[model samples]
Target: MLTQEPIYPKPFLKWAGGKTKLIQQYISLFPQKIINYYEPFLGGGAVFFYLYNHYFLSSAFLSDINPELINTYLCIKHDVEAVISLLQQHQANHNQEYYYYMRSYNTENSVERAARLIYLNKTCFNGLYRENSKGEFNVPMGKYKNPQICNPEVLRAVAKALQVAQIEVKPFETVLNYAKSSEDFVYFDPPYHPLSETSNFTAYSRDSFNKDDQIRLKNVCVELAQRGVKLIQSNSDCPFIRELYKDFKIYEIQAARAINSNASKRGKISEVLITI
Candidate 1:
């Protein structure tokens, strides 16, 4: 009999500002050991997946303010087979016409909604999640010659990884409620404070993360640090963010993102990694 090799999971969504590429730079920064891990702004969840794959974690708290996203996670965690079944349908029927139909679709079924979001994510322009003034997904269909709309292997692995996590929909500040000791580690990958005028793109959800929210996040970090909670945050390396976490140990991380509206501004940018 052969023993099966463990399958490590990567992020299932193609979220904007995802830290998948930056994980290498963060590896040395992540705590060697942690009992509890919390990620408040769980976008693509590259960091959470990374930590789970690399370290020994007893518990994890993953959350985001996006209701649809949270629901998708719950559906996948609870019933990945249902999601895969629906995704297989989407994968088989994927076409330009069907893509728009799925985009304009409204579904109350959690499994169907999760499948729709995943389909759109793979086929949407740049895998960008942008909502309109009326709070509807407004991104156009992407020009993918062959998009992998469904991958049961990846989804199953993701579901297995999430079995140990308590996923939720909550504000970033709510992290302070549970994380209170050095054993608790919080990795914040908030909607960054824009570095330039053209880069102030926060349309990931209906409620934009404005400057006030940035300040509030800083305060939470300060408080978490005070309680001896291990922390690592990723944000734009701008003066404002710099001044905000002035006392924390800041390291310059080289990052490149194509999320800016201006194509010219999407290359080798500097981001800050604050640790405590």
Candidate 2:
């Protein structure tokens, strides 16, 4: 019997700092071949999904600091049908009140939580994931006339893609435990340093990624570089960041920004891609 081929899956959720647009421009910076792929801050996982679909990945290790997001990935990887079924129910009952209700809903069921997150992400304002000091998801409802709440094809595709990946909820530095020297590629897309005082939106979890965290990441990059691990990292083009990774090769590129609340602030902005 002939089996159906897995469809190429794009990012399932709309992330604030998603790299979907820059994947093309940054394509040249990606390693030609990867034995193992490591993404520590796997927001929306655009680059990981893209590379996996394109057959550029042999094995992958994906991790993030957010427990909810990691749980969603785990649900999809282990029981996509259950997640999709719950999403279908959500699609049938979607409304402003329903959105708010689901946003505040807490559940121990992995499938339900995953479905709820996908629902909120699809229907939330700008598809941005923001958490309050208490670690509660607080983004309000979006104004999309009609949102795609349940797409079975996309969910199935995502499930297929995640089969080869080992997803985890861990600190970025833990990648050192799994990655082998000279045989792995690690892509770091941590929260970018705030461009200005008002542009800070790094709170995907209750914990904030401050300047010290940035420095720690740079130190990890330095250690990985010395160990012969290939690395690619993206962050805001700022003096602090430049000095942080001064020993590596940095390339500045313009990436469009649409997550800003102010219309005037939404435009192309300079970002840096550091390689080692």
Q: Quick one: best TM-score, which candidate?
A: 1
lDDT of 2 by residue, 5-112 (tens): 756788999998999989887889887778899999998999999899775576999999899899999999999999999999999999999999999998888889
Task: Record all residue pairs in model 2 with backbone atoms less than 3 Å apart, i.e. clashing.
Answer: none
* Model 2: ten consecutive residues of lowest lDDT: 49-58
**C-alpha local distance difference test of each model:** 0.91, 0.90
Which regions of candidate 1 are displaced past 4 Å? Answer: 1-6
As a TM-score, model 2 comes out at: 0.96
lDDT of 2 at 111: 84
Which tens-of-lDDT digit does each residue in 199-243 have in candidate 1?
A: 677757789888999999999999999999999999989999999
